[model samples]
Target: MKLDILAIGAHPDDVELSCAGTLIKETTKGKRVGVVDLTQGELGTRGNAETRTEEARQAAEIMGLAMRQNLKFRDGFFQNDEAHQLEIIKLIRKYQPEIVFCNAIHDRHIDHSKGSQLVGDACFLSGLRKIETIDDSKSQEVWRPKHVYHYIQWYDITPDVVVDISGYINQKVEAVKAYKTQFFDPTNKEPKTPISSQNFLDSVTYRARDLGRIIGVDHAEGFTVERYAAVDSIFDLI
Candidate 1:
């Protein structure tokens, strides 16, 4: 199904932790939003691929996503090449979302930057008619998103755009907590990891609030763009 916005991530929880508030805000306004995870996060220390998939489903339900799919790319070894780009291109053509959200341009995780470039390239190539792609053995039409935004992750980067998510931060928190195995859990006997700490879990909320305060909002999500965002009038921005 066509989507108004598509959020792509290197792993399952990336989108939720960074931009689920924006997704929730959009969905509440009757917009169709979807998610594409590049990997199952099988390589994570705390959860296996199977558990991560289930958690992703739960998060999707909480976020009210219209569709959620994984590309099954290798967790840490996926390359940014034609093969990878084609995979992303197929989904872009299928969804035809006007706006696309992807991983940060650069991050601590190698996969995040790789997935960022892969999705960005796919967005541009998907618009080329000569780049033939097929779905279900039938020829697919070329499609490209109008805008591609890279959401902040694990780093403090200046944002080109920030969306006010004042009333929807709780939804973001709930959606993130849906991945119970990946976040802080006193009952989890698994070995501790970078993201399994109480501080890490709390950072999610505090980060949003910090960004919000910069823009006179209660909560917000920040993103970087490939190009300057145009506005019709100065008053169009809040």
Candidate 2:
């Protein structure tokens, strides 16, 4: 199905951690939003692949996503070669989204930056008519999303734009909590990691709040853009 906005992450909970608030806010406005995870996060310290998949499904429902898919690329080892780019290109064409949200340009995890460039390159290549691709044996048309934005993840990159998600913070929190195995959970009996700490869980909300404070809003999500963000009038800046 055609999507208004498509959010792509290197792993399962990456989208929830960074852009869930924006996705929730968009869906509330009657937009068709979808998610594409490049990896299953199989290399995570705590949860296994099967459990992560189930958690992602629950999170999708919580966010009211129109579509949710996992590319199943190797968690930390996926490369940005032709093979990988082609896979991402197929999704870009299939969804034909107007806006695309991808992994942070720079982050603590190596996969984040790699996934950013992979998706960015794929979005561009997907628009080339000669790059032939097919789905279900039928030739697919080329498509390019109008905008590609990178959401902040593990790093505090300066944002090109900040989206006010005041009313959707609760939904974002709930969607993130769906991944009970990945985040802080005292009873999981799983080995603790950097993200498994209560401090990290609190950072998600505090980060949003911090961004919101800078923009005079209750809550907000930050994103870095490929180019200068412009609007038809000065009134567009809030």
Candidate 3:
């Protein structure tokens, strides 16, 4: 199925923490959205890979995503190489999304930056007819998304665009909390990680509020673009 947007991340909950509000907003406007996680997050401090996978599924349901898939790449060691690019390329062609949202260009986690570049590169390569891919015993056609935007993660990067997600912030929180094995939960007896702190959970809300304050909105999500973004009219900018 053709998707309006495909949000990809290095780990399962990355998209939920960073851009699920934007996805929720878009989908509410009748846009079809999907999510692709590059890794299962086996190396995360709090949860096992199997638990993370279940969490991802729960989050997908909460977000009402059209599709959710994991590439099963090594948690901390995946590279932005040909093999990795090819895997992403196949998904791009299969989904044929118009816009792709990926992990931040740089982040605290090494895999986030690598996955960002890997997916970005694959988006470009997917358009080349020479770089062939196959699906379901049939040769797939080349398909490139019109744009790619990287959502801000651990480090706040200046965004070329900010999406107003004030009304959907609660949905984003719910989606992130679906990963019960990862986030701040006092009830759970698991060892605490960086994300398991109450402050980290608060940051998710505060970060969006901060971004929104900059743009005169109640809450917002930030994104950096690789190339110039165009609009039909200046009034489109808010």
lDDT of 1 by residue, 72-177 (tens): 9999999999999999999999889999999999999999999999999999999999999998898889998889999999999999999999999888999999
Q: What TM-score does structure 3 among the candidates reach?
A: 0.98
Q: How many clashes show up per model?
A: 0, 0, 0
Q: Which segments of candidate 1 are over 4 A away from where they belong?
A: none
Give candidate 2 regions above 4 Å deviation: none
Candidate 1 has a TM-score of 0.99
Over the stretch 1-238, how does candidate 3's per-residue lDDT look in tens digits?
9999999999999999999999999888889999999889998888799999999999998899989999999989999999999999999999999999999999998898998899999999999999988999899999999999999999979999999998999999999999998988899898888899999999999999999999998999999999989999999876
RMSD of each: 0.7, 0.8, 0.9
Worst 10 residues of 1 by lDDT: 135-144
As for candidate 1, its clashing pairs are none
lDDT of each: 0.95, 0.95, 0.94
- Between candidates 1 and 3, the one scoring higher on lDDT is 1
Error of 2 at 146 (Å): 0.3
Candidate 1 lDDT (Cα, whole model)?
0.95
- At residue 146, give the lDDT of candidate 2: 93
Superior candidate under TM-score, 1 versus 3: 1
Error of 3 at 234 (Å): 1.5
Decreasing TM-score order of the candidates? 1, 2, 3
- Error at 62, model 2, angstroms: 0.3
